[model samples]
Every structure is written in C-alpha cells, then in structure tokens.
Target: MPSADPSTQPLKSAEELAQSRRRFPGESPQYRAARNALLKEEIELRRHIERVAAQRRALPPGGEIPEDYRFESESGPATLSQMFGEHDTLVTYNWMFGPKRQRSCPMCTSFLSALDGEMADILQRVAFAVIARSPVERLTAFKRERGWRHLRLYSSGGNTFNRDYADEDPDSGDNAGFNVFVRSNGIVRHFWGDEMGPETADPGQDPRGAPDAMPLWTVLDMTPGGRGTDWYPKLEYGAQSKTGT
Candidate 1:
C-alpha cells in the first residue's frame, strides 16, 4: 500500500502515540517517563526518514551512465542494463574485496551476510547485486564459503564500474558503497547513492549513512552497552569471542 500523504492527513502528537502503547510489567514511573520520551523521539525519527525518502523519490532524473559498464557474473559477461533483469530499478552494493586484499573487509562482509538473508524479499520488488573488485571466481568462492545462497555476486575487475560507482582509489583501494540505478525509456541512468563517508561523519561516531542498512548496529543500539567505539566485525570470530553469534 502507498503511504498516506502527510499534507492530506491530520497528524498525531508523538507523545500521545507513545503513551498509547502498553506499558511493560514492573517498570518504574521514572523508567516509563524516559522510555516514553525515547519512543516519541523514535516516532519523530521515523517521520524524518519517510520525509527524506519522499524527497529522494521526487528528485529529478539523475545523470545518464557514461557507458554500459561490463561486469563478470556467474553466467559470464553482463552489462549494467542486463543487471536490472526484469525490474526497472537496480540496487548494487560495492563490496570491498579488491584483488590486493588478503580477505574481504569484515565490515562489508558483515553487511552482505545480513543482505543475503533479505535478497529474496528485496528481489521481488527490485533487482539487486553485489559488485566487487575481485574476480568473479574469487567472489563466488567467498559466497560459497559464506553460504550466501541468494546474493548475485559480480566482478567489476575488467571494467571501470568500481572506479565510477564504488569510489575505487589508486592508493586507498576499494571502498564500500551502495548505488541505485534505473532503466527508463531504454536509457539507463544513475539514481540515489549513499554518499556519506568519513568526511560526513559526525564527531565521535562511525561514518554510517542515515537509515543504516546493517541490522547488526540497529539491534546493538537498543542494548545498554550499545555499539562500542572499538568493537568491529572480524573476518572470523574465534571460539573465545565474548559476543554470541
């Protein structure tokens, strides 16, 4: 169903809506007050997210792609237009698995691990793929090892797709990114992309984009300890790791 237009509908105060929720058992009045205030803020945050999405959707057509970037997929060479499949919209994640890296970045792998689970549901609406600098075989090898059954892994090693869309740098190597493209009226064009980077990061925070795509941090944020400053995902967690998988 389509979202109701805010301009056409009357709004409810977040405080009122928060209070409407059922209270937990054995919670103190002080706890309830703080919880209610937090809930109100969450509601506001949700509204802001929707507003931003609406603005994104309303944006004028983005620039046309410079070329039909070539990529190596499991079935062999495929063009950017072919990546869309039957859907008009295509979403791609820039995986940080360059040929030079011994192993893929744990952070990118972590996000892909989470994305793999939802690929089926997401593909039902739009085409999705993971683009990396590593060779297609290397990407598939890692996919098999990780048991990622749904992700469509591709290699941009032969083309400038990574350099153009994934922010590949000569000195810094592959950087993780998310890009959306659209096929319209026989023309493929660039759409929205997560432009947030280290330069955009706020003080004392990781350079994470708004509406964070990773469920790991989303779940962690609700905990008392939260996502700590030093803790990060590893390629392989040892048996002695404190956190449970």
Candidate 2:
C-alpha cells in the first residue's frame, strides 16, 4: 500500500479496504480474514452515521411549538421556554410511565438508567430533561428509587405536552419518545424527534434508531450472542449477597 497521506491518494472504496491482510494472535487465518473484512464495513458505518448527523443538523427550522406548554418540575410549575436555561437547544425524553400503568416500560427505563449517568456531561452542551405523564410526586418517587441524581425530571400530568408531542398514544396510553427543540430570539421550535417505531422497523429487527441511544444494546451487539432476541433488561435483578455464597 502507498505510504502517502490518505487525502493525497484516491479514496479507497469500502471493498478495497476490506482486503486488509492484518493478522491477530491466537486466531485462525479464516477468522482474521473475516475480521479484517468486517472492520472495513464498520468504518463505512461510522462515516454514514456522521453523514446522517450532518443532514439532521442542517434541517430547516421545524414547526414552531404551538403554545408555551406547562410542566411541573422540582421547583414548581414552568413553561417550555423556561426549560432552556442558558442554552439555545433542549432535548426532552418522554418516559413511558403513565398514571394508569403499573410501571414504566422496561425498555424506556433501561435507556434512561444509562442516560442518568451521562446527564451531567450532556447538559454541558444543551439543556436536557426527562418528562413523564405521571404526577410529579410519582415521578419523583421513581427518580429516588432509581437513584438518578443528575437527570432533571418533570411531570406533564396536567398538560397536553405528551399528547401534542407524540409521547402519549391515544390508543395505548404512554409511549417513549425523544424530541429536540431549539430556542432562538425567544421563539421555541421543534427540531427533530425519533419517529421510528414498529411501522418503520425492518424485518426480524426491533424498531430503533440508526444510532441507538442505549449503550447496553451497543455493547451486547459486539458479543457472540449479538443481542439475543429473548433477553431484555428488567427493573430489578436477582439479589446477591455482598459476600460470596
């Protein structure tokens, strides 16, 4: 292969890159060859993710929010605009924990559990909040139960925010949704949302976004089992004593 800078030479197609002959220890020649081929595809997948993200960022202004939706936060009532403190961008994740449901969706809970750890880092760039249709007290209790300290939790119990934002399914009650909004010159406008659901899911695959928001699934994907279809996160795992049995 040429040693010149990659930019100086013609771009290598994914197919050409798959021809890498690198080898690893304790691996059969067949496995090494297959692994090298897979690496090229992974590289292309990364580039595609960046390309789609750029397209999303370049989207024209989305529909302006119809009203200043109200919500109940830890510090009393607040409006949509108030949620965006010092940033022009806001990301709201709608949790599927409705008043009528016994518990929140396991999938949503799993995703939020991971997000809670990253809330501080995520907030440095943009405002982030978690909204649920349950009463503030109920939501707060769950937050405490989960030991989520960084996620800013809010209640949409008395507002139409959930209904208007596709977070509440009229026929099925609560649903999980991720919405992004932008505030410019005192105007709040919808930016983007994860609209992919059962309708958009591919054959034999779950309905999920291109770049999954949950790290659990991503990590599991690299394993030999490849995210087994029968397994999913649970609210609580079997108890284990501190000391080894």
Candidate 3:
C-alpha cells in the first residue's frame, strides 16, 4: 500500500488532537513544546547546510589536470585530453568495483544511478564519466547487472591511474571514490574528492557535496536521527533512490 503523505491529510479536531498527561512513552509537561522547538532548529540547520553547499560550488574548480592521465571508457581507453573534447574540464567518479569484489558497490551503484539519469543536462557542458579501477569487462558486467543505461562507464585498472589519482588501495580492500578533474594549459589536475571526511567537508560548517550529491545525509535527514550516528552508507539494493538512482 502507498504511504499517506501527512501534508495532504485532513487536520484533526482540536479535542481529538489534545494529548493526555502522557502523550509519549513518558509523562512530561514540556516534552511536546521542547520537540516543537527542536523541529525549528533542524529546519535552520538544513538551511545552513544548503548555504554551505552553495559556497562549495561557487568556490571555483581549481587544480591542473595532466594531459597523459589514462581513463578507460566503454569504447576502450582514452587520455584526459580526449575525454574533455572541446570542453576544458572533466569530472570522473571512481566507482568501487574490482576483480576481487563479488558484488557491485552499493554507494557507488547509487551515485552512478543518479549520474546516469542526469547526464543529459551536464553533457551539454561538463564531461562526466564513471571510472573504475577494475577491468573494463568487469565494470561493464557490473553495470549491466545494475541496469545503468545513460552515463558512460569505464575501467582504469591497468596502470597506477587509481592509485596516482583516486587513492584506491589494492592491499586495503577499501574501494570506490569520486574525484573531479580539470584541464588547463594542457595539464590535467585533481580538484575534489568524496573520501576525506571532517577536514574536507567540515560537516558542521561546510557541506561540500551537500544534500543531493550524497546519499547518507539525503536519506538521514528524512529520519528522526538526522545523521546523528557515525554509520556509513552501505552497499544495498534500492538504497539508490529514484530521484538519484
């Protein structure tokens, strides 16, 4: 059954809405009012986060991308220069699927799904592609299973591409990341990535990726927890929402 949206529901009568001495699990005269104040704080916090994300996008894309950086693509391999075409900047998402991992990564899967659907608008300007450290064939198969249709996918497992660029550690088994690259004066440079936590984002101050780009905060904000704990977004099917995935 479809869930009923509270926004569309009819309001309760004043008498019906009135609570007894114990409205919640415990009896408290101030609990309801206290919760109401917290709701306002949350709304303000969200607005602040939005403000920070805007700052990050507006800060300017920096760093010089080299010309010789090899990025594998669906049509085989191509250098960073070739990927940019007439456009000077290129953004590559480091997808987390490798030969050793049996299943496609959940977070990367979700991120790619969102990018695939939204590529048409960005394609008119920025060059965006998903790059994996895994072999092209392996990455292709993984994408097929996920039914990813729009965005281009590639593999750069052959060389030090992932290591020199995206920070993939073959020995550590920690995989998948996203990095934005820009080319200027025939040099390709790395600008932004999603791996670093507090230092990179300053979640309390600078919400770099912000609400839409990341899955954790987007999903968390809907719940009562509101990104309260330190839980990481897991690799699970259906976690990639339709708005994004």
Model 3 Cα shift for residue 232 (angstroms): 8.8
Candidate 3 collision pairs: 64-188, 64-189, 65-187, 65-188, 65-189, 66-187, 66-188, 106-235, 114-244
lDDT of 3 by residue, 48-158 (tens): 786676676675656554437676788877876787877766777777677677766666676777777788888888888777777787778777876777777767776
RMSD of each: 3.0, 4.7, 10.9
Candidate 2 has an lDDT of 0.86
> Could you tell me which residue pairs clash in candidate 2?
none
lDDT of 2 by residue, 131-233 (tens): 9888889988988988988888889888888888865664578878899999999999999998998899999998888898889989998999998887677
Clashes of each: 0, 0, 9
Residue 68, candidate 2: Cα error in Å is 0.7
Question: What's the CA error at residue 39 for candidate 1, in Å?
Answer: 1.2
Best by TM-score: 1
Error of 3 at 90 (Å): 1.8
Stretches off by above 4 angstroms in model 1 are: 1-7, 240-245
Clashes of 1: 0
* TM-score, prediction 3: 0.64
